[model samples]
Target: MAERSSTMKTPLNKALAQRRSKRRYSRRSCGEGTYLGYTSGRQTVLKIPTSRKKPKSRDITNQVDPDQVALLVKKEWHLSYVTPLYQFRYTMLKTYSKELSAFLVSEKQQGQTIETGQELCFKVNISVVLGLAETNQDAETIYIQILSKQVFAAKDEAQKVVWSGLLTCINGDVDYLRSLPPEFVSLPLLCTSGPESLSALVKSWLKKTFDCCFGPICITSTNLQWLAALWTGCHPTKNIQYLKLAWTIPTQPPMDVTYKVNPQDVWKLWDSARLDDGAEDSINIEEVNSFIRGLQTHFFRHFRLDLSAGSLMRVSTALGSAHHSGKIKITSPDYMTTVLQLLTECALLKMPI
Candidate 1:
């Protein structure tokens, strides 16, 4: 059997050798920087040297950090890609900062909200479980009726917010974010639901943007670490480091994702009475605020967070502290006071603005 097998291999080797002898070996083709034409319907190729190619096609550029850019651009991008709202917020800075700082949040009171405040009330809705129930008003209304605080500090502190209100604001943005190709949503902090179709659409966009903005080697083939980070950020649980592993590569043969944040984990975090530490921490407040500032800087920025009056009060504290710390400053204190009043006014109104 061995002799016969060896004899057969000799014929196969001879056949392969004959084929290789007849074929021509060619060098790598300079297919790029070449133009095509036709002569008498016959195709012709005009090879342009690589040096002749347009510089713009080869010369890479980067996007602005997005932090320093005017808010108008951010707001435009948000509306075109993120959301649609009735009124936009215009800030009045009270202090100043080299980077981040105090914005005099100014707006008029929603008189309609105060007038119709009597109409707002909580009522029972649906029974999801044998014991657990969803109030009808709770399910539909954007916010539960709340009174105006005489003081601004009380307004910025986050209290209980209606799920409906969250839905109204985040839902549209979520849908828009989902609808967009992955590239659009691939901005560092902006993550998507862990749906393959969603991420696949945007992944290339992210790769290109980061590559173009940062550098070609910004994301190479071994970007599992990047994906791992994104996976945790997008997962409903808001647990960016949910998958624990030694942050190394190759030697350990970085294993496949073995653990996933469960649905229960997300519910526990998102369905809390107040802001969970995980939620607060998961969201980079400083970064997000910077992005928010970007939104307001140029185009009108509208963010209808449920925090409303009370939450705004606490925000005012940060705005003030950051203001004093040289993190932020307000050029218009009157405007700042007015903006603060307007935010409280909206909260008292329970209006989704």
Candidate 2:
């Protein structure tokens, strides 16, 4: 507005020009206070670290190594849906108390390399109650339970524990673990199953562990043969009786006790006989006794007061061939007249108790 100025640039315009020129220059070369008008044009002090970059993962397998974690399964336990055992160690971080998910990521990245059969070690808490699990003199069974439930119980424990496959483990192929003994080794299911079911495993483990924990059975088997896997930890007489009892036809139904029976074990001795189909199932004395009892009762009733010829005939037919089994021979009339004569004799005796 004032006509006295020859130069046309205003003070504001000069300041703006200086600012543009300053922006063109390297900020490092400019004086500390120089204004270039870029966002937050001044460097500020930071008390905390900011230059650290987020780490990148190096894992490619989504798997770790030290594999061999599928052999530790118990005979009685049910296993399903298993990842390899070694991966457990990679997945879990050991600690007293921490978030489960957080612990899973310890020092491990998505693509990091892990050993085969790496397992996550877990510390479990178990309080002993007598008569519940058994007297816990040392309280170590808890550790066994944890291993069984978490890592070894995984369908893959045979791979992780003793290095075995599903079929091998179930089919009695993994006997190396038996040498270790349950007490010393802390196997998952310590006292169950046969060779097919881990009974052999159970027996060997008992001998080893029981010897270590308690001591030798003061009474070792007089006959070493009695100590075999077929022995079943029972006396000879009782074993035979049990076999007989086992033979009873289960009032309910019969099942296969021979081996590889997946489930259900209730049956009378008679029922067990079906297993014998005269085949793989072992037959004992009790079952045969039951058969004899049924046969004798069904075919002949010699103690009756109302015996008749027909009844006598049946008795003779049943007993004539079977008499070899009895110490005493019965003298009854022949079939035609036996019933009538027996009635007269029974009337004379009058001993119908």
Candidate 3:
């Protein structure tokens, strides 16, 4: 009976060891579709599936449908890009041909900056019809097609006549210039013949076009007199912010005229207009002085101006009075300083003066 019991104990011990080993290496079914399986590693560890499904490519039709995307109708359009050598086409609609023509002329004239390609679109109250943009690799030319149909019905006859005259000028038909309303007779001068004519053209152009929404005007010509005049004249009435003159040294010196430096103009321009409604004096003494002081401080900090030159020195001297001893002994502004001050003042005042 003892020998039989020993034999059963040996077999029972072996069976229990086998069951324990199988339990140690068994696959564990985790929650959901995932399961942990023991792989080639000797240690009992969970192995996650590494398989990923390959993406399939589906064939789509090559044809493009215009209706599939939003249309560009009745949207305020501006010059997207204009290359120096590019040609422009105006596609007129059946109605409002004059209005469309005027808008086209405005766009073309506005794109006359020396910058090769400019994104200088301003508030002109014009809508785009078909802005056809075509790129030519071999010829290196960009053709801009402005399809100017009846984008918006004119509110009044004034709007119609204003635009029609502008279109006529763009068409190089100056015969309509005299017949146009007296206010817009100057519009025809925008068809610039050469550099000699640009000064007058720019002056007339600014007078006719510079309104509340004109953002920036970059003059590449070396004519500083006209630039200063245009800059001053436009900024007072309109909300023009940017005035950049592309200065190039002319081979021959320009007309021998003394360029005056009037820093008082800056102060006058910077100061906000008084309320005609008879509200209390909005121009606080401390506030106005503080604003001027800040602007002068910033200008001196960024740029080096000779404080000894001309009438500007008077203004510069007065600038110190607002804060410190009100007596800053400085010399006249040098040539470069004068130019810098002119350009800086214009650029700094991004808002209407």
Candidate 4:
């Protein structure tokens, strides 16, 4: 009996010693800046670009349908970041449209408190906008329009478009995009312009169908600074008309400052700050800092206050307008891709690992 008990104790002691060795090894590996199971050769951290190329100013109206472009430019879109959609196909848009329409109608019926004749009927239209993709890996932009009419309306009455949404990924990170599995389609940015309730219902439907998630993507102060610099850089090729920035100072009453700069004045400052004499096609972080400093200095000289001390809340130019609350209005199609690329980076940063 004593010999048998010793044999069992030997294996138990050996197993406990092995676990202790593994724990020590793991701690030592972590101290040496290494993960035990992961290879250092592959990058696990996502890196966002600090500098970007100046957008080329080209008319895209001829490239895409005018009506679609009009819809995108006319409305102030609320932004959201979406996760990778599983099993999403561009070929089944018609089926998706029908299904979405039915879903909306059924959802409305369940929550309806109105009389029968006053009930609202919905129609959903989904179409693929061509020529917007910047890479082969990118999926085509999907445009959805929801029209509504009274259930008992006359046949000749025209239905009104109550909601519009766009899902697109332009100039996405190739490595991160390629890392996704074949079945997952990465359209990480969503822009919707419509009622909040309708947006919530649509998001719920998408979540149920695609097995994904959506979250609001608020534009941070840093991102707004980037936009201000990027849009100002385009003044040479495209007239920005005016540059307007809104700042909120935490004073006794929370003062708001709206500083508007002349286009030519800002353009001259930007040109003076450029490292290359219009030779390089890209803008760097140093140049952006210089441009912003010039503006803040000028404002400080006039107001006797530091504009940099306040929070940047909004930025606007002829090309587009962006607010800190995730609202954007793209007024020009020439630089739309560049703007979308920046927004795509923001959305990608919000993705869950």
Instruction: Give the CA lDDT, 0 to 100, for residue 31 in model 1.
Output: 22
Pull out the clashing pairs in model 3: 307-330, 307-331, 308-331, 308-332, 309-331, 309-332, 309-333, 321-326
lDDT of 3 by residue, 78-125 (tens): 111111111222332222334433544565476643221222222223
Q: Candidate 1 residues 316-336, lDDT tens each? A: 111121111111122212122
Off by over 4 Å in 2: 1-116, 133-143, 147-189, 192-353
CA lDDT of 314 in candidate 1? 8
Off by over 4 Å in 3: 1-145, 148-224, 234-243, 250-353
What are the models' TM-scores? 0.14, 0.17, 0.18, 0.81
Ranking by TM-score: 4, 3, 2, 1
Best by TM-score: 4
Candidate No. with top lDDT: 4
Model 4's alpha-carbon lDDT is: 0.72
Looking at model 4, how many pairs of residues clash? 0
Cα RMSD, each candidate: 27.7, 44.7, 35.7, 18.3
Clashing pairs in 4: none
Q: Write the per-residue lDDT of candidate 2 for residues 175-271, one digit (tens) a residue.
A: 3223333333221222111122222222233344233121111111111111111112111212212211111112234321111110111112123
What's the TM for model 4? 0.81
- How close to the true structure is residue 33 of candidate 4, measured as C-alpha lDDT? 35
